[model samples]
Target chain A: MSPLLLILIFIVSTVVGYMIIKNVPSLLHTPLMSGMNALSGITVLGALTATAFALGTGSKILGYIAIVLAMINVAGGFTVTSKMLKMFKHKEVDNK
Target chain B: MSDILFYLLCGLLSVLVLVGISMMSKVEKAVKGNFLSTIAMAGAILLTLVYYDIISVTSLWIFMAIGLILGVIWGFKIKMIEMPQVVALLNGFGGIASALAATVIMIEPEQQNQDQLMFILVTASLALVVGVVTFTGSMIAAGKLQKVISQKPVIWKNHQWITGISLVLSILSIVMVAIDTKFLPISIIIGWVMGGFFGVAFTIRVGGADMPITISLLNSLSGVAGSIAGMASNNPLTVAIGGIVGASGLLLTQIMCRSMNRHLLDILLGKTTSTGHSKGVAVEASTVVTASDSEEDIVSDLASIIKSAKRVIIVPGYGMALAQAQHLVSQLSDSLEQNGALLDFAIHPVAGRMPGHMNVLLAEANISYEKLREMDDINPEFPNCDLAIVIGANDVINPAANTAEGTPIYGMPVLDVDKAKHIVICNFDLKPGYAGVDNPLYKMRNVTMKLGDAKDTVKELIDMLR
Candidate 1:
């Protein structure tokens, strides 16, 4: 990937993401934040690549730790967000 | 995978993530939206393994499994009230992950052309600095939220000077590493140490009330860090998803800042939540109400007020969460409805420790989402309300926001609780809230202050109706 192309992707994604997230009501802001928090852990891709291409034991260990931490962020963030969203039930739903 | 095919897949996955986020705007579809995002993430991870030819890496799978187990356990176990700190801690993990990945990139020998190597080195160093700062800053924020550290703003002597110097040094180190590969080892150390100091200095002076903004900002930084790390590694998928997270966090930060009428720069410079501290003391002395009636008389008066009310609005704040009084609040709302009163909850955007946190707490207590109204939607209804019940809330309902010029909360939007015909307050004490601005609403004749732990006071109110 060229640097110019990568920068373009970042800009396009950010603008589109902002427009989409703007529609989320304040009622769901907490879940939105946590869900976004999970997406930030997409850095796990970088970690995996770095670990795979690592030349030294030290670099490999660091990559492993990064992978683990990013996975925790992704898994935990999504799970907690789902839990919170589940609690937002309507009166009719509660009655049922 | 060929480069063309890989880029196409990245684009497809990014769209899926965006569709998932758009679905979050509606309550009904939000759960499925989260699941979709989870699937997209899993797909992205699997794609990385195959594209990079690392599918057979045993150590990677073991580490990821360990993380998955821990994450699931913690996610299921955390109470709603602890969401702020837990989110902060998770943000730290994401930050450190990016930092570590950047570090590995910096350490591994590069086979790229000279220009490409320079770009990669500079971006990697930048990512490491941002990632480490986000990690340390989030840990401090989590500590403050959990009360492991003091919630009061910690202002060291010449705090701004320290923060400035550390930030400058960190940037300089990044530049040096980019200019010369020989400075890599020393530059990495300087980046980590200076970045850590800068993070702590930046966060230590942010008082508890400013946490919503701080957490949002740190969340944004973590995403930016991940995006930059992706740039360093030339991973388009990481860059795209990380950018989306960054944008989402920035939007939330903007909303939180607007709701509080605070400037992001003022918060970054640690100028908030401290201006009214001395002024608060003077206001408190003159405004203390001396109850002329006995305790029973007060209770009876409140009970009578509740009995006659036909429409009610409940305002809940962080103190309500602290008192674990949501259940009692839910009960009170139920009892009020039984008396034929139309009831709704007014949620300030900055209420509780994080954005929309009060709603989650209320939801946990079995209050239906339909009854929760945002400040703008509910403010107009207050004037028509027969009574306003404020539970462990102060600044959000403080009438001073409208009249008290030069105060920290001046011009900040607040729930118009005073517009209601009658008001009842259940708070811990008469002390000023986190922003240190004394509430003028407590002095109004139409308002009755029930000073005690919100749990006990709300339970008592429930008992009175029975």
Candidate 2:
């Protein structure tokens, strides 16, 4: 991808993301933040590509660690967010 | 995959992620929204493997599986009160991942045209700096939140000067990498060392009460790091999703800053809660007045007030989380409702250690989401309510924010608890709160101050109602 195209994609995504996130109420801000935190782990894509193309053993090992860390970020963040969201129950539900 | 087809798939996945985020605005659809986002992420991962022709990599799967297992366990084990630290730690993981990926790219640059090589190298260097900083800064923030490190702001001698020099050096190293390929290895070392030092220096001076803003800003930086890593590797999917996350974090940071009536730059420069006021005199004076009124008499008076009141608003702060009093608080609210009082919880945006953190704690105690109200929505109703019950909360309800000029909390919006006909304060002490400004509300005749552990005090209220 060209540098200009990459910059355009980032700008467009950021603007659209901001507009969409503005509608979420303060009530769900914690879950909203944690969920976005998980999305930041999308860097796993870069890590995977780097690991695949690595020429040296040291660089490959670094890429492997990156992949693991990013995956943990993705999995841990989404799981915790779901757990929190589950607790936000309405009054009419069966009470704990 | 052809370039055209690959880019089209990236666009499609980005829209799916956006739609998922939009669904998060409503409570009912939020769980499904999170699931949709997870699916989009899975799709992105699969797309990357196939497009890059790395589908048969056995070790990658092994590493990812290990991470998944650990993440699931940690996510399940974490209590709601510990959510702030957990989020901070996970953000650090994301940051370091980007930094490592950027490092790998820097070590062995892909053979490309001269123009493309320069762009990639520069973007990779930038990514490494941002990622390392976010990683170290978030670890410090997490340590502070968990009380593993001192929560007090640490001001080293000439702290600002050291922070400035480190920042400049990190930037210079990035510039060196851009100028010549030969300087790559040495510049990378300086970038890592200086970036890490800068993160610690910048974060250590921020006090505990200011953690919400700091954590939110670091969250934004982590996302920006990931997006920049995407730029280094030329991955559109990573760039787009990372950009969205970055924007979301920035929005949350803006909300937290506005709610606290603070400037982001002030926080970055370490101008935290301490305003250098002489708070000892004010605390000593208030303790004497409270001593004259016996604890039993105050409890009985508060019980009667609670029974008689028709409308009540409860204000909860970080102290409530610290005392683990959410359950007792929920019980008290139930008892008040049994006496035929209409109840609502007034939650400040910056309450607890993070944005909306108080709500999660309350939710964990089985308090229905319907009963919680934001500051703006519930502020007007305080005057009409017959009683205001403040549980371990101080600065959010402090009337000093309105009348005390030159204080840190001056002009900051607070709940109008003073407007209620009667008030009950259950806090840890008579001292001023995190803002270090005396609360004039404690001295009002209509207000009864009960200084003790909130769990015991709130349980006493519940027992009196029984």
- Where in model 2 is the C-alpha error above 4 Å? B111-115, B276-281, B284-288, B291-296
TM-score of chain A of each: 0.97, 0.96
In the range A1-96, model 2's lDDT, one tens digit per residue, is 999899889999999999999999999999988998889999999999989889899999999999999999999999999999999998767553
Off by over 4 Å in 1: B111-115, B277-288
- The Cα error of candidate 1 at residue B229, in Å, is 0.5
Q: What is the DockQ of each candidate?
A: 0.87, 0.87
In candidate 1, what are the lDDT values of residues B1-466, reduced to their tens digit? 8878888888899889999999999999999999999999999999888888889989889988988888888889989999999889988999999999999988974733356888788888999999999999999999999999998889999998999999999999899986889999998899999998899999998988889999999999999999999999889999999999899889989999998889999888888765656553635534445644576787788899898899999999888999999998999999999988899999999998888899899998999998999999999999899999999888888888899888888898999998999998898888887667878788788888888999998988888788
Residue-level lDDT tens digits of model 2 in B259-309: 888899888888876675555646564665555578677778878888899
